[model samples]
Target: MGFLGAPVVGVDELVDRIDPRPVLESRTIHEGYVFDLVSETADLGEAGTVRREFLRHPGAVAILALDDEERLVVVQQYRHPVGAFDWEIPAGLLDVAGEPPQLAAARELGEEADLRAEQWDVLVDYWTTPGGNDEAIRVFLARGLSPVPEAERHEREDEELGMPTVWATLDNVQEAVLSGRLHNPSTCIGVLAACAARDRGWATLRPADAPWPEHPRRR
Candidate 1:
């Protein structure tokens, strides 16, 4: 629809799409524990072929846990690349082959926060860095929170060790995001999306098992 005298663009064209180009040349430059750096040349038909380098990721999942009082659970963990202990939603990589994303999210929630949820919904999905990396992350909204049994909790290691968790109101988190305080992509997108979904009576939420066609593994 047009707005404020602006031209209306087709809604169908607004979505990101798969425009597969013929790969002219490709090679892995570096192999890392988490992701691989790859360089490739693609034939863009009339636009000509071009080469690019990016990190090929296996995708990931994040959980935005909310309690009955509508407080969100956020975790603080040191990110070496950024050199800061950033606040983020419970999240982890999709490293296990053949595991479902929702299950992965549940696992992250338990492992990172020592919590579990009785209900789950797809909050949002996004690419962390489309220009330089192929990392896609699916965020899930988790409700009906409870602590995991002490005997069954996963041990934290490295950056995860000594991590602290906090429960904040959704509005406060949203403000933090808008004010450029919270920089984690999953946490920012997840909280803002949760607010939007809640405003719409959660009618916009998708099933936890919703198809994620954009995931590189799925492709």
Candidate 2:
């Protein structure tokens, strides 16, 4: 099955079972928080079948928080891999198989930013790094936040992996990205999606929009 002229490729059978050799591979073993060792063993043209082992994960989510005051809630924390702080949107992984992307988005907001949204409108779903891995990211826009005291939330090692919570206007976000303050790729994409949705008058970020799942226009 091909979407266009390119044939849809799928791993249908096992040929060779060998641990991926780092030297023979083109990608590094560890990237950021992910172990990204990719197998470079696909057929080119006249070569025999080649196969390699790789790790697979469920996928993840990122949330763009917008408020009525025109503020964007971001997080700043040091990423051990880069040895630098990243200002990014609230995001997390979906550990449970078959877990809904929307639920993961809502739960990540509570864990990472301590803010509850009345409504969440999904903006986009995409792959963060599509070269070798299949991990997809679901981006959501959360509005009508119920302010939970920042002190009440406990940071998990993964959540605290880089982002810790900072509030900035859209202008500030743009400036930070320009000044080397924000470096997370997924966050940047989410911010742009949020901005686009906001322009269409689709986001609700203040408490006035509270208890959002109850709203008729939210979905």
Candidate 3:
């Protein structure tokens, strides 16, 4: 073993504690919200120690805003968990196994933003609270939008609760982060990445919605 308990494994070793035991388990007790406790188990001696824990659903996806005019997209909704409705971006969990993150992004844009992108690029993929959950958000940068009729879109059970899409400049979003208005990491990172990707000119995709009037700068 290496340090305290770190193993001297090869650089190619992809998994930690190859024999990791399922420490505990559970199941989803509700809906519309994220996290469905899947199962649980126990870990024995040697490779590690004993611990209690629960399994969880894999995760979902989040997409930053796009104005179809090379601008950023943001959405607003009342997050009871956060206790206030604020402008954020489009995001949701994947319900189907083997579903593509890009497809999910397209669907969310249509359902939440009433827009669709002509092109979608993989932005970044990361786990959210891996220490306690298996949830991961695969973010994508969408460009080139086309509006889908509201009738064709299936509003999420909670969307009727009022999730609406708003668009803004990336610089504005960066400012919101600094001022403490935006705290969602997925939104922050996705916007930052999209900003950089814009300069790098990843790829141009068509947009579904007509560009909205620019909101006055946040003082």
Candidate 4:
């Protein structure tokens, strides 16, 4: 049978069957504060061989924090790469060794948004750009939020020092996203996923510390 003029197929039939190419050689080309550039040669079996360069990222987390008013907590910060002030969810790099992604998310929420959540759940996971980078991100849904104690607040540094945090309605965020005013990948993914989760009564959300075998930091 066909649906939408396309032949239907079982989910199992859509699984990738090709084996991953074997890496022939790999070397670090540059090391930066956040990630490293690496060049690699791989044997692609029937496709012959190829050499590619990509970033070796340390992974990161984004938090979609919703407060009692159902407003999203977001941060407006300057991203040097894009040379623009981006409206993004509370996020940070997973540079801390051995720190769980959830903990990292919580820490970023506190530091960037100055809020703490008593409830958290895994919303989504995505690769920022698998074609050229190994950067993976986990988006989390946080609720039951309260301001972090002043004494325990984290001081911002560098680009984060002057960044401003705000709370916005989901409708306004969706408009910004659709209008291309907000282009941050994490923010886009987090907001869209949060919207879907909310529509479904958040039944799709996983536990805050859900097992993430695919996250490199966890492995």
In model 3, the worst 10-residue window by lDDT is 210-219
lDDT of 2 by residue, 1-219 (tens): 576676666676523332333333344444444434455555534555455545444567788877888787887767777887777788877775656667878788887888888877776666665445556676777779987677876567853844557788876786767676667977777776666667877553333222322111122
Model 1 gets an lDDT of 0.93
Of candidates 4 and 3, the better by lDDT = 4
Best by TM-score: 1
Query: Could you give candidate 4's per-residue lDDT for residues 1-219 as a string of tens digits?
Result: 687788889977974333457999999999998889999999988989999999999999999998776789888899887899988998989999989889999999999988999998999988888889978899999999998999999999988997888889987898899888899998888888888888999898999888775555565
* lDDT by residue (tens digit), candidate 1, 105-204: 9999999999999999999989999889989999999999999999999999999998998999999999999999899989999999999999999999
* Cα lDDT tens digits for candidate 3, 47-119: 5544434436546667775664666777777777778776767877677665655677777777777777776
Superpose all Cα atoms of candidate 2 onto the true structure and report the RMSD in Å to 1 decimal.
10.7
Model 4 error, position 37 (Å) = 0.8
The RMSD of every model to the true structure, in order and in angstroms, is 2.1, 10.7, 9.9, 2.6
Report the CA-based lDDT of candidate 3 relative to the real structure.
0.64
Misplaced by over 4 Å in model 1 are 1-7, 10-12
Q: Per-residue error at 38 for model 3, in Å?
A: 5.7
